[model samples]
Target: MKIAVFFVGEVRDAGFNASALAGADVATAEGLAEISIISGVRYDQDAIRARLAEVVPEVDGLVFIGGQGNITTPEIAAQYPGKKFAIVQGQKTGPNLASYDVLQEDSAFLAGALAARLTQSGTVGHLSGHRVPPGLKGRAAFVAGARQANPDIQVLTGFCGTQDDRTVTKAWAAAEISAGADIIFTMLNDARSGAIEACREGRARQIGNAMDWVEVDPEVFIASAIARIDLGVKGAIKDMVAGIIPDTPVHLGLAQGDFASLSMGGDVLDVHKEYIAKIAQDIRNGTCTVPNTYDGPEFQP
Candidate 1:
């Protein structure tokens, strides 16, 4: 299969692409496919549709990573047929498109739960990047999970409204830490480095999003909320190989071994190993539900 990856802006900095790209690489390793990248996707729907129109005909499979996010309406896919589209972290649905919706709240909740347990000050902080529905869902779930662990646990939440301004994000983290938030979930996208730095300097712990961060800073990072975008990519590719391009969006979450999980590397994790396992099972079995998004203010300790 000759597949082209649709990158929203620069291919180098797209956080959602890492796992999908890894999936494509895995298919390439199996000698089943070749990968090509397409970039410069504008946020506008018309522009994105046009861009896809220009690129779709050339590739056997079209994978749009973070292209206009979700398609609760399916007009775009109908306009482009024959070519299969694998959308990672998107909510678009259509016969020609296989969209992957990674329910990050599951892992986010786990992160919140863990954070609740870790804090001696009864306070934890959450820092967010750009506002997207899924991102909002993850943030809300973090608070919910923390509260689940400790009803009295204080959650200090804030949004930078931008993903790359490290200085600004660092300030946000600093403020939260100063307020006695010992652990903060830095969902500040690319600006997370600054928040992590702040957490380290303040002697406050930090949580990772998507990929593991322990190797990056073991002393500061207690754990990472593992969002399995990789599974979405790999699964979509296998579907492509099977000769069927799903029109509906595929939901990936804890139930399918794609649970946004916390890494088992930390000593604290070992302590909560049983709890984590039980919770994972509950989430997988549909006994426990994590809200993807919630509406609220910046909660304080």
Candidate 2:
């Protein structure tokens, strides 16, 4: 069997994309599947449609990794109605399309809780890549979690509008810190490093995304909400290969090991470990509900 994975941005050095690629590699190893990966610089509907038309015929299945906005766009879906497609972040329901959405809000909530517990100034900030649903959901969940931990906590917010714009993001992080935000949470693809730099320069703390950034900024990076998209993609491929594709979306969360908070590499502070453990248990026990970009409440700003 052959699978084609279309990503929104280049996966050359991105931690999140690398994780998804690792998942794809695992699927190939187990199922003897041939995989082809493609990435575009922007979420151009016409471009994605043209590319899909050119490549879909040769592949057995399609996997859209990350970039919730671009993958869920109506234009792309309309062009490939009958093609078997699976998306990682957002929900796009169709006859041949399935979504393996990550329970990001839950993970973000945990990160926020940890940030609140670790912050010394009682002020946390969220640096978003865009004002889009996924980014906003992460910020909102973080705020929700932080509030739960400390109602008096002040959560500042900012956005870079795109994931690749590191300069603007660094400026935003610096501005947030200048405004008295000591603990920062960045939910960007490659912009996480820029936020880390701003934090390091400003002498603040940060909660990294996708993977921990302890090696780069150990003193500042308190934790990371790591996502493993490979498991979901591999499972989708298996179902498609077996002709067992489900009519409903495949939602992966802590239960499926698709998302979690990592304390490895000294990314998580010792003080926040207990809080992270408790939140992880809450997610597993269904007591703590995390938000979904598609199903959760819409966020403004």
Candidate 3:
């Protein structure tokens, strides 16, 4: 079956779009489904909607990656009865729309613990594109995880003002590094490449989100928190193909290989795997509850 995904940025995207594309490609290769991706640069909601409107007829289903507010709203989906809809990072308003969600707090907790255990500088930082839900929740979980490992470790935060601006993002990372944050978890979408560059220049290790960036730069990007949008997309497509798509939102977590997880690369600190695994287990079992937001200081560049 053929599927279409409406992404809010260019094809060379870094965070969510890239991961979803990667997942879609893999799904096609594995014979699960075929996917066509369409992008409209951020904020051109009208143009994006027009593109999707044009592309929808050619595919069996349409997946909107972060387009709930732009491409199609609950009202819009309600108007398209026969069109199968799956949304990555969207709200569930009614039947025929499947919303894919990532349980980021679990993986962010893992990342925080990893950062605190490895940082030579006693301070860890989070770089983001906005002070929004998943990013904020991830950063907050990171802080909780870090403190759970080392109670006194300081956490730094910064925002790049936009998801696609690398210059601003890179500068933010540099400033965070100058403040002695040796490990940074970047959730800045396409701007993450900038943070990775900054980490390399500062000789600090980095953690990425939404993809298996364990080897993005073996030296600087030593860890990644996976938000597996690809898996979510693939699963949603499979359900659509099978005519069993769920109308309510689908939440993927540690138990679901598709949702989120923190992976340690070979280049990172040689912390015992069991230590990290235990934290993950606690999160999965509800033994460790990760707070969903951090009311910490956030700098905008």
Candidate 4:
């Protein structure tokens, strides 16, 4: 089977795109499918649609790598019903298309809980690049977790326009710190450097997403929401290779092994780690519900 792994940003982003691309590389090496990577498309809708149109006709299957695919992938898949389509971290699905989500929100919730417990200023912040569904869900879960941990804790959250714009993210992170946020939860890609710089200069701690940022920088990162995008990509590719297009999106979360987790740095207290563990169990046991939508006002930096 000939399958194309598609992305809307730089595949070497060292964050979301990098994780998904790693999975595609493994699948290709294992001979699961004849994989072709189609990257370098901008975040613009027209660009994504154009790239999809150009590539979908030539491949037996196309696996889009992010929630950006929730829109254009379905439209393109409908145009080519004979071809298999899947979206990792996506919500939409059709007969010929499937979506697989690695529940980052589960770990985002734990980050919020940790932030609530760790913040000395009684305020925390959230920053993400796009206003996509997965990012929105993560923000909502973070806010919900913070609220659950401490109802009076303040959460200043915003969605910056660009994921890779270091200047924009740096300014945004600084603004959140200026607004009294001591711990910021960031869901970004290559733009993460800006947030790290802001945190370091401002003496504020951070929580990261998609990969284990705590492992990368223990001093700046207090915790990391680990979401295995690579696993989702591999699962979608395996399904596509086996010609199994499920009717529903494949959902993987904390209960599904280490697909999603909240990794804490050495600075985290033992008691707080136990608290986060209990919360994770509650989410797995359905006792705690992570809100998917945040209707509250957005903090504009």
- lDDT (CA) for every model shown? 0.75, 0.70, 0.76, 0.93
lDDT, candidate 2, at 121:
85
**Between prediction 3 and prediction 4, which has the larger lDDT?**
4
| lDDT per residue as tens, model 1, 1-301 | 7877676544444245455566667866786667776775654677776777787778787766653546421455576676676677777766776677777788888889889988889999998865766678889889998998899998999877656667888888999999989999876456777887898799999988777777667888888887877677767677776777666667778887754787744668466767777777788999988877676677432
Model 4 lDDT tens row, 1-301 = 8899999988888788988998999898899999999998999999999988899888899999999999899999889989899999988889999999999999999999999999999999999999999999999999999999999999999999889988999999999999999999999998999999999999999999888888899999999998989989999999998988889888899877778899999978899999999999998988888889998888887
lDDT of residue 223 for candidate 2: 69
lDDT of 1: 0.75
Pairs in steric clash, model 4: none
Instruction: Give the runs in model 4 whose Cα sits over 4 Å from its true position.
Output: none
State in Å the error of residue 209, model 4: 0.6
- Candidate 3: which stretches are off by over 4 Å? 30-34, 57-60, 67-71, 267-272
On a 0 to 1 TM-score scale, where does candidate 1 land against the true structure? 0.87
lDDT of 3 at 253: 82
Cα RMSD (angstroms) for every candidate in the order listed? 2.9, 3.3, 2.5, 0.9
In the range 1-301, model 2's lDDT, one tens digit per residue, is: 6778777666754656766777778887786467888776365656666677777777767777775534443345556665567776656656677667666666788878887877788888887765655566777788888878888887886666767777877888888888888988888777666777888899998777766565555787766766656666677677767656566667777876646554433645565687677878888888877654323332123
Model 1 stretches with alpha carbons more than 4 Å out: 9-15, 39-54, 71-76, 299-301
**Alpha-carbon deviation at 179 in model 2, angstroms:** 0.8
TM-score of 4: 0.98
